[model samples]
Target: MTAQKKCPVCGKPAEIEFRPFCSKRCADVDLGRWFNESYVVPEPIDPETVIADDGEGDETIH
Candidate 1:
């Protein structure tokens, strides 16, 4: 079984409706914060490696 986490924003129990967030407001806040650069995901991309691009110029690793 997996452990459940509490909502960090409101300190309330998380529900499935909002997932890791507690409510739609919280979810929207998170999204807005992300859009405003408040949150960032640290993903490492190798400069030497080239990503495969599809014909449409969309990159995907095969």
Candidate 2:
């Protein structure tokens, strides 16, 4: 037998429709985190490793 995964939001049993989430609310909550910039991957990009922007835009720090 296989164990079911719990919802990352509320630790409830995940529904098939929601997959990793228990419901649309939980799924939306997760998405909200992304939309609100609550989720981030702290990867220190070296300045030399970054490519310069070809478009007309303000200078961005690496």
Candidate 3:
């Protein structure tokens, strides 16, 4: 038998309609977290690899 997945918010068995979450409440809670910036997706940037324009009216950067 396959195991049921629990809701990430409430630890309850997930419903088919909600898939990963147990209900609309849990789903809304997750969405609220995103809107409130509780979750963040990070992008890393390297300064040495960055290109800066020298204002020579050219597309190439030094």
Q: Per-residue CA lDDT of candidate 2, range 1-62, in tens?
A: 55789999999999888989999999999999887775565777878668665777775755
lDDT of 2: 0.85
Sort order, TM-score high to low:
3, 2, 1
Which tens-of-lDDT digit does each residue in 1-62 have in candidate 3? 75799999999999989979999999999889888784454655667556554655866645
Better of 1 and 2 by TM-score: 2
Predictions in order: lDDT: 0.73, 0.85, 0.83
Clashes of 2: 0
Please report, as a residue range, the 10-residue window in candidate 1 with the lowest summed lDDT. 50-59
All candidates: TM-score: 0.50, 0.56, 0.56
Give per-residue CA lDDT, model 1, range 1-62, as digits (tens). Answer: 65666776787877777889888888888788778784565565766565544457635655
Ranking by lDDT: 2, 3, 1
Q: In candidate 2, what residue range of length 10 has the lowest lDDT sum? A: 53-62
lDDT for predicted candidate 3 compared with the true structure: 0.83
